[model samples]
Target: MASAESASLGRKVRTAARWSLVNTVVLRLGNFATGIVLARFALGPAEWGVYGVAQTVLMVLLSANELGVGLAVVRWEGDLRRFAPTVQTLSTLSSGLLYLVLFAAAPALADALGSPSASWVLRVMCVSVVLDGLAQVPNGVITREFAQIRRLVLDSVNFGISTGVTLGLAFAGWGAMSFAVGALAGNAASLLGAVIAAPGAFRFGWNRAEAGALLRFGLPLAGASLLALGVVNVDTLIVGATLGKVALGYYVLAFNMSGWPVRVVSEAARRVSFAGFSRLAESAGPALADGFSRALRVLVTGTVPMCVLLAGLAAPVVGLVYGHEWLPAARALPWLMALGLTRIGCELAYDCLVAIGARHALLAVQGLWLAALIPTLFGGARLDGIAGVSAGHALVAAGLVVPAFLLALRRGGIGVRVVARACAWPFLAGAAMAAVLVGLPRALGHSLLALAAASAGALAVYALGVLPTRHALLGVEPRHGRHARPRALLPGPSRPPVPPPRHSSESDPEPLLDGTGADGVRP
Candidate 1:
């Protein structure tokens, strides 16, 4: 019975991972393509710089307002319906207050970033904060339920609307305001979709007990989030302050381009793995350990090669897609790509800790990472400008963040030796691919088509090189006890059915947040 349940959970994880991957590819690709159009044809570096500064400030505020409540919602094992009202009330009130604070502080932040126009942009974008807060309940509900397809549809709708509006306004010469306005529109649309998809009463109610429980679970995660905000945006802030807006613009562009692999692949895996790991942690022991190991293997295998490819092909890619005017971005890409590679491991480790409710440990790791990152980032910006910032960021990630992540994983029973073995083959494969890319003939490397072909060839070589480790790569072997083995990467028909919840009652609604219903939606 235990083996059957493990197999069932594994199937669900695989399915969720697949759908999340689809969503990430579609949403990120759209955003990436639209950004190219905005950077190359519609907006200049100075404009992107202004927008980037405003966006960074807004993100910091948003992270604070969120306070990691969505994670609390997922991690909670109690009755979610009983808990919903308190979550909603706290979220709405906090966001409203945060918005007021951001609005008041906009001018000062704008002065700090050296963009007078960013003051108004920051004020305008603060409206989405409240809307995002209101939507968190439903968003959390959807994710908790593993309703990936519905989530995907909503994300697609939001991305399409936001991109269209932003691009249209950019072409109309609205500049940075285009991003602010488009974000507001997108948030509104997404909120509406969430309400429709996960309909439930959201009224003013407060339960002190529930709120306390949530705070205990969420505060440490929120601290980690705050530190993360620093690690991600402090460099942008430093570059804008020291190097001027145009340089910051080039740096932001390179940062975005280099983050494609992490954002699309690692993040996708994280979305699924967090929930799966949370569920498995209830069972604990070898099941959770094995799940973590498999997830780590999958994340490294997929992301390392992509990061290598991006770093190796940075110059041609930037020149062809975004034009030569943005060539400065190319120079920063390799360092940023290296940073992304290390980040994949760090982020996965963070998620694993969160799933197991290891908040203090998570906080400690993030605090250490932030401590290392701030001085390194500022020092690099002062020394070598944008490229130096990128190099410093990569150095901190590889040196500090990666080691911290490995340590955190050890707390969850994932040994360093296990992680090293999983990562070894992918790194070797990626190194071979990087070598081939570097050795490509100049004639073939000069054109976009040739570059694309070369990249495909390199990927093919990586695939072939990793073929000997296919079973481990695919996680075909069960990591724990000898029992029912999963066919392929998913559960088969022989997998056992899950038992009904013990707490079900006539007055209580079904546990829609548990993803046990047929439609996978809350009524």
Candidate 2:
């Protein structure tokens, strides 16, 4: 019975992962294209710098905006209808309070981040927090049920509306405020879609006991998530404060450019990772460790070439995509690329930890990261400007934080040996790919065709190098001299059919909350 249940949920997880990957890839590509247009004509570095500050603030706020109760919709057994009203109430109230605080303190906060001019932008853009709060219940329903197809349609609407509005306003000379307004419109679309996906999901009901249980369960998770987000966003603050807005702008561009693989692969995986891992934890089987190793291997293998090539081809990519004026961003891109690769592994580990109720451990690792980051980041900016900061950020993530996380995972039975094994092949392939890209002659012109050809060549080498990951990607455990098909993707002839998932008398518990369903499109 237990094996059957795992198999059923495994099917759902794989199917959800497929759709989620599609959703993230499509939206990221759309956002990337829109960003190119904006960078080329609509906005310059200073404007982008201010927008980046506002964006950083929004991401940080959104991480804790709901106080983390929304995930309860995914993890708890029994009828969601019993406690969903309270979840909505708690989410809405918390977000409303947070927005109010930000509204009153925007100027001071913007100034602290070295962007006083962005005070208004921060105020306007953070309105989505309240909208996110109101919609968390419905969105949680969507995630719990692995409803990525619905999410895709909804997020597409958000992308179209946001992109159209931002472009129109930028052309009309609204500056950074254009991004804020456009984001507001986009979040509204997200809310509407969430409601449509799960009707009557946003109701206000307060059960003191239920609310207490939720807070008990959620606060630690929220704190951990906030710290995790801080580990990523605090650099923007440090950059803006230690350097100037223009330097901050360069760093932001470089960092975002480096995030291509992390966003596309990690975002999609995380949308379902917590819920899936939570289910796996309940089974208390070796499946969690096995699944973790496989997922980590796949992510590292797929992400390696992208990160390596982006780092190697940073100069051409920034030059061709954002124009010659933005070439300075290239210097910081390689270091940020390393950071992006580290984040993919760490984030997957984070979801696994969160699912197994390892919130304290998460808080410790993330807090240590943020605590270490402030000094390193500031010192780096004082040394080599944005590039130094990027190098410093990557250093902390790989050197300090990655080891810390591995220890925590080791405590959870996912040994360092497992991680090392998973990472060994991908890391070797990435290094080889990097060598090829870095060794390439500078004779290649800065044209699109030239960049594409170089990237294709580097990636082809990477593909061949990581050919052993093929079985893993297909969801089969790889063992030497034991080649077998992945039953997850294509079950064998004699394998029993996975049993259908049984619904509770009250509701199906299938989805979880992602911190950014506060809607994570950067400005």
- Write model 2 residue lDDT over 1-523, tens digit each, in one string: 5456556777888888899889889888887888899899989999989988998888888788888787787777667878899888988999999999999999999998888999999999899888878887887888788788998888888888888888999999999999899888887887888788888776789888888878877888788878877888888888898898998888888887887888888877877776677666644435678778877887887788888888888887898899999999999999999999999999889878876668899999999999999899989989999998999999999999999999999888789988998899889888887776666545676567766776777888888888877777778665577866444521211222222223211111121111123352211
**Per-model lDDT:** 0.72, 0.79
- lDDT per residue for candidate 1 within 150-193, as digits (tens), equals 87878777777777788899999999898888877777787788
- Where does candidate 1 stray beyond 4 Å? 442-453, 478-523
TM-score of each: 0.90, 0.92
